[model samples]
Target: MKGFKFAGIHAGIKKNDQKDLGLIYCEKPSVAAALFTRNKVIAAPVILGKEKIKIGVCRAVLANSGNANCFTGNQGIEDARACSKMVADCLDIEEDHVLVSSTGVIGANLPMDKFKTGVPDVVQQLSEDNVDQFADAILTTDTCRKIVNRSATIDNKKFSIMGIAKGSGMIRPDMATMLAYICTDIHISADDLNKCLSAANEKSFNRITVDGDTSTNDTLMAMASGTSEAQINDAGSKKIFQDMLDDVCFELAKMVVKDGEGATKLAQIIIKGAQTKKDAFKAAEAIAHSNLVKTAIYGEDPNWGRITAAVGRSGAHVVPEKIDLYFDDQALVLKGDWQGTEAEKKTSQIMKNSEITITLDLNLGQETDSFLFCDFSENYVKINADYRS
Candidate 1:
């Protein structure tokens, strides 16, 4: 935050009046690390970002919403590059020092004219206080911006880390989720920053789902400005930085789910006591992505059978008779046996809460994994039905 300036402007690319262009400018060239979508058909910006991030140093980020630069063949890359040039020229930095990103409707060419006019104006408005605007500009169907910050102190030297994210739907990530950008003022090498980010992401962005659709333009990146003079050359300092990074990333990830399109409830799916971590994750992923399970939560229905069926079909090694399920502390199924109508009624009450946890005890080995997700609603359908109109 000390070395970063941000801006967001209405570029007129979106149908409404919301800001469509965003910028993140670092006063000094900063160490950078990035992860992209696992979707084979990635957007042009992702292709370019993969190349740019290899240098491990960046001066700026140019991102736009409402027009995902995907599937436009060679032209898409050119457009993404051209947009980067606009920011670089305006900021008086080398073109290669700028990273680019986009989100919104897929397979459409960027309206270069909108960017042509919008880029310069947005760049002129950059300031350290403009991060909220930058957050807004990167959103698609998200109801609100997601931002989290944490601080680490070592020997009285303090450093701050800030994370900003934009996502609502198409939120499952194989490696990265939606569009997340992290900035910190800690003095750390690019390799060290990459290691910390990779670890933090596995526990955060990689564990959330909305509609189970991975975006073509998913990106998670971090930049370290070294402005705070808090070096991480040793394990002790690194651990402090890692803890702060993890908390910021996890909080932003939860905000993304809570603001998910048409979502009314935020829930954590925990698969505990599994034979292997893989099996735990497999069952949790299945339950998180199941429409029946999500809709049942939305309707406050005590439909434990949907949850049972999902775990059974998840390909996870499980002893059917050894499974126990609960909504919060109210057990709906105990050792594969229903707790009956009275318990169902109480479980229904748990489901009505804005936030709750679903725990599945496999009664197997000690390995376990978890996921964060939100309930599905008819508004989710309505929101996506005319997303392009």
Candidate 2:
């Protein structure tokens, strides 16, 4: 944290005249790990970044929002490389030592004039205390900044981890629909860092959904500078670090869902008593991604039928009559039967709040899983439909 410098600036790429460029630079090379979207039609920066992260060390990262460099074919790749090379030449680092990422509207060409003008200003203004500005620069439709920081002790040595992310729409994640950067001061090998990062993302980013549409550009990168010298070289140490990293990523992931565009309610879809853990997650995600369920939450309508229907179509084995559902503490359906007028009233009031929970019990086994999601509103449609305009 002491040696890392961050900066953000408005480069005239974003139409709103807000900051859309960011940089995170280390005085020296740092061990890095990253995850990108599994979508076949990926962005140019993501394709370039995968190769850079394979080098195991990176000196700086350049990211831009409001114009994703995807689907422009070979020109897109050239543009992405040009951005990185510009940073490398200016910072005196090798081009391969610089990583690049982009977010926002896809299939558009990058504005080279902005990069030629903005990158230098950002480099000049870089400082150790610009974490907030860096977080703000990577946003697309996000309503607020998402950040999490933690300090942990391993082998009597203390280390710090800080992460920031931006994504609010086009958010059904294969890796994650946005971009995130996590920095730590711990000493861990690149292989170990990648292992820990992949494990952490699977259970956190893979479980959440907003609109069920994955983006063409998505990346999550983690860097450990070994500044703390808290060596995590053994299996035991690796497990501990992995757990802590998962907790950090999971919190930040939920923050993305809670701040989802046009979202007025945060909903937790809990599926329990399934015969298998896979079934639990499938059922939970299906419910979370359902438009009917989201609209119901938006209107403060305690529609238990939508919940049951989603569960049934989730392809999970379940007996409807044996199932139970709840909206908050109000049991809307008990033993798969409507709990009547009083329960409906309670659920209606619960939906009016900013946060709500829907629990489904299969009454089969103990396997369970849950997902964090937000309700769909008119704003979500308006934001994405008119995004480029």
Best by lDDT: 1
| Candidate 2 residue-wise lDDT, 1-389, digit = tens | 75578999999889887889999998888899999998898899999998888888988999999899999899999999999999998899989889999998888999999999999988987998998889889998888888899888888888888888998887875887488898988888898899899988987887788888888888999988888868797888787788889999999889989988899989998888999988998899889899999999999989889989999999888899999998878898888789999889888988899989888999999999999899999999898788889
- Relative to the true structure, candidate 1 reaches a TM of 0.98
What is candidate 2's local distance difference test score? 0.89
Candidate that would win on TM-score: 1
Q: What lDDT score belongs to each candidate, Candidate 1 first?
A: 0.93, 0.89
Candidate 1 Cα lDDT to native: 0.93
Per-prediction TM-score to the true structure, in the order listed: 0.98, 0.97
Q: Which residue pairs collide in model 2, if any?
A: none
TM-score of 2: 0.97
User: Total clashing residue pairs per candidate?
Assistant: 0, 0
